[model samples]
Structure formats: structure tokens, C-alpha cells
Target: MAVQDGPHQASPRKEPGCLRGLVALVVFVGIIYAIWWFTGGRDGDDEASSTPSVSASATGDRGGSSGEWKAGDCGGPDPDRAPDGYEAYDCGDPDATFRALKIMDGSILPAAVQCPAGTDVIIEVSMNSGSDVKPSGGIPTDTVCGRNLSGDHPGDAGAGGGQLVKGDCVTADVEEIACDQAGPGDLKVLGLVDAGSARCPSGTTDPIRLTIVVGRPYDTVCGREP
Candidate 1:
């Protein structure tokens, strides 16, 4: 039987479906953000780490380590017997065997022809390697034309002639002297020519012949007015 309606009672509150959906959306977005942080966000650091690094020694600049030689630098053979490499040394050091006269691009064989007239030895860096290899921690390929300071070559046989090269100052007796200290009688070397076949270049006078033996001429150093 229908009873008289009592005072209207309030229904228990239920959470809205939109609020639940909003919470689920916020959780989903948070998960996506976390995934991105772990993956894409670290890409910059990974790329930075993957990039190749260059070292000071590979640059072949002045004051760099051994095998990285430049013009006017001093070095010596690493093993002294059929050396495969060179070790850099101070110019004044007693162990220094050769002085770099020039630095040329490419392999040693081709670059040897470009060496100065007085070059006695050649040091090659990264021979047979490509130029692009330097960025990957490889030495820059180059040829170092060097002059032997050990007084072993024929050019060094005579008195002070070994120390002299083209464009160097010398006395009438073939003694090497500083250009600043040269006197009126002193002469400047125009070129060093092979005495066996070639004559002194033009514009030069008083070609001093350097002999290794008593009669065999080794080289002729052409001289000019200082």
C-alpha cells in the first residue's frame, strides 16, 4: 500500500564521470611526459657525447707533442734504428737531431720534392692516411722537411758549411756567421747547388765549392753581395 510521502531525502553524492575522465587524462599526460624525458629529452646529451673530439696534439701546432711537428721545430728519431716515428725536443736539447725546415701537405714521398734545398731528412705524419682521419683522434697527415743537426751529411763536412743553408751568411772561408754580424767581405748564400752537374745561379758570385774528400766536390754554395 502506498504510504504517505515523507519529507524528501537527499541522495548520496556520486563523483561525476567527467572528473574521473579528467584525472585519467592528467595521469596519461604525466606518463607521456616521463617517457619523453627518458628518451627524446636525452637526445641532445647523446648527440653531444657522440661527436668526435679534437686534441691539441692532432693539430700539429707549435709546442705540441711528438709526431706533431711544424716548421722550425726540432725533433729526433724515436728508435734511432730504422725509426718509424719522431720525438719532439727542444731546439737547445742535446737529443735533438734534426730541425724542421718546412711543413708540406700530403704523404712523405710526394712532399719530399718540395723540401727546401738544405733538407736532409723527412718526417711523415699519418702517412697513407686521409686528411679527414684527423677528426677521429688521428694525427693530421703532413710531411716535415728537416735538416740534420747531427753533422752527418756531406753538406756538414766542411768548416761551418754544415750549419749553413740557402739564404745564410758566410765568410770567404765558408764559415757560417749571423747575417747581422756579417762584414763587407761576407757573402750571403744564393743557393746550394750540386757541384757535380750544376753551376751557381745567376746574380751570384764567388761560388764556394764544398768538398767531402780531397778532390771530390760535394756541393757548391753560391754566394752574393750581402
Candidate 2:
């Protein structure tokens, strides 16, 4: 069986990697993504509360909060329910009520919304996303966090948005470069490409198989291309 093609999207080529202090760039299907620097605003406890960290605060408001908090808020301990009125931090501290990493586009929501399964997305809100952005004009809304492309990698993962991915090419950066060497600053995932909505062609057979075109780019990188 031939390897099915996914989104044909390709990341834009930027300068070589490995420059400190330079903002990163990720190219996918021609779209470029910068860093994930949106700040979640101040925590919302009016009174004193426990200091909130990414982990501890993430679980506090799974149910959701009113628009009282914007996109960047993290919740502190429930002052009314706790033995002490104040959470770890007094009211007014950024994390006192909300711990913001970045602000998002949209109105505040009453509850946290979850992205559906098989969604072609990169970022999952580790903390609460204060506002829920609707599918503006019917575009669909996914957490815009996974914009950054870092961490240990399998070189290649399953296809997304119908794009066949492998190591670095698996990223929108399909071009050849010394990613392991580190230059153009750390790479980020621009977006998915080769977007074939249907995993298999219409009236196709089962057990869909895919192949990495030999002699294509990434054939020699890491010495493991098929």
C-alpha cells in the first residue's frame, strides 16, 4: 500500500537555528507561529489565598468561573471554604486569584470547554482557559497553546489534519536543516498541512498504509528515514 498524503502545508524557511535571545519561528503549510507568551491575568480570590502554581491551581476551577476572570486568570484556594480566609497569597497578587500566562481572544466563559477527540491541535490548556472563543464566523476553536514546538520527540508521529509527518518534516518545517544542531533558534510547530480530510480515499480499502517517499528530504537525517 502507498503512504497516504496528508495536508500539503509546509512551514516557511527562516534563518538557520541556534541563536539565543531570538524569538522562535515555526512554519507549517506556509503559516508561521511564534512563541506561547500569552499571560493568564491575576488570580481571582478577593481575599487572601494560598499561593497557586500551575499544577495546584489547574484543578481548582475545572468547573469554570464567571467572566469575572478573563483569559489569564488562575484560581486560588476557596477562601470562604478554607480554614484561613486568605489563600497562600493575599488578594491582588497575580496568582492570588488567577495565574495568567497569556490572554486569549474571546469572551469569558462560565465553564472550561474541552476540545473534541481527533482534533488537529497542538496545545492543551494545562491551566484553565478563562474565556472560551467561539468559532468566529464558523472557523472552529481549539486551544491556541501548543504553538511552541519543543521537548523530546519521536522524530515522527501519526498524521494530523491529513498531513503525513515524520521527524523534522513531520513538523511544518519540511525543509532540510540541522535541527539537532540548534540554529534558527528553537523551532516551533507552525501548523498542519497536506490537509486531506478523508484519511482514506473514497471507496478505498481498509488497513490504510502509508509510506515515506525515499530520496525525499529527511532521507538521511537521524539516519532512520524509510
Candidate 3:
């Protein structure tokens, strides 16, 4: 005999493969993430570690007396020093106005020093007071024998204006000037004579003597009247 029907209870619905499918999907996603993390994703960190750092001094961003300067290096006038001092610059840069011929220790006095034959100007860097035409006594000073690239005279520190090259044209007073600006009476440089030698090239009409500093052997510039 059938019993009286009690309240019918719904059995719990079971997903046959839904749970397993969800687990597999989670594992697949994790594997993909792991592969990405181990391969291309890790390259960022490796590249960051391998990259080289740029120094402020090399780019002349320090903007003051602090930086590495050497012979044959070119530079511009430092704005901080205003009418004096020098800042690092690329030789090929248009702003480059001076080329270093020699660097001397501070122990020597600027008055007692003689720069190289081709040096057109001199600059003094004081360790205690930045860059100055004159350094305070007893401090570390760096003397820069520089060749002025600009045609203008570099104040009193300059011997004259710019140093003359073989192809340069100069005025009758022995001042270097632009070739195009040369007048009918201007002279053209034929060659340069050594410090000890007085004889210029065979065709040199004028042998002009050039002096960089006191007591140093002077060079002779051979020039021909234009």
C-alpha cells in the first residue's frame, strides 16, 4: 500500500564536470601566467639592471666648477662665472668657444706661468671659490691653458684674439680675422716656424713673432702680404 505523500523535497543539483572544468581552467591560467613571468615579463628587470647610468658631469649638467676637464676638450663660458670660468662642451658644438691646451696644478701662480705656444687665453679654477681669473692664495687652483675659438679677445687673459692657423688671414697688426673680412693690406699665413728657428718658408714676406706668456719660447708665424 502506498503511503500518504509527504512534502516533496528537491534533491541537490550536481554539476558533473563543472567543478573539474573550473579547476582545470584555474591551472591553465596559472601556467600561462608563470610562463609569461619567466620569459618576456622578466626582461624588464634584466634590462633595467643592465642599463648604464649617465653622470651629470659628463653632460655638463652640474653647471658649476664641478666636472672633469682635460686637455683637447672644448668648452663654453660658464654663466655662473659670468665674464669668466668655463663649462664643459662638445668640441663640435657651436657654443664651444675655447679648447684646453694644458691643465696645471694650483701650486703655480698665474703670474709665473707660461702657457703653451698656441694658447690664446688662461683660466683659473679655485677649489674654494669656484672659477676666477685669480685664485685665493693657498687653495687648490686648476690653471687651464686655453685656445680661444672666438675671434674676439678674451679680456686681459688672452694674448691677443684667436690663434692663427696656416690658412688664416690676419691684419697688418698681426690680429687674426676672417678670411672674407680681410682687407687688401691684410696678410695671409703661409706657415709657422719653430720657437728656435727664425727662417720662415721661402715665400713668406712677413715673419711675425707670437708670444703666449712671459719667459716662454715664442713661435713665429710666417705671413704674406695679400
For each candidate in turn, give its C-alpha RMSD to the true structure in angstroms: 28.6, 21.7, 28.4
TM-score of predicted structure 3: 0.41
Q: What would the per-residue lDDT of candidate 2 be over residues 1-226, giving only the tens digit for each residue?
A: 3444587753444323422213332244113211111232334231111111221112233224522222333444344534212122323555453233333332122112222222222222222333532211112122221111223222223222211232222212333233344343322222222224323223222211223432122221121221
Q: lDDT tens string, model 3, 154-226?
A: 2222222333446666776666666657778888877755647667878888887764532233367678875
lDDT of 1: 0.54
Residue pairs in steric clash, candidate 1? 156-162
**1 versus 2: better TM-score goes to:** 1
TM-score: which candidate is best?
3
In model 2, the runs with Cα more than 4 Å from the true position are: 1-67, 72-74, 77-98, 101-190, 193-226
CA lDDT scores, all candidates in order: 0.54, 0.26, 0.53
Worst 10 residues of 3 by lDDT: 47-56
Q: Could you say which candidate leads in lDDT?
A: 1
Ranking the candidates on lDDT from highest down gives 1, 3, 2
Ranking according to TM-score, highest score first:
3, 1, 2
Candidate 1 off by > 4 Å: 1-67, 80-82, 108-112, 127-140, 155-226
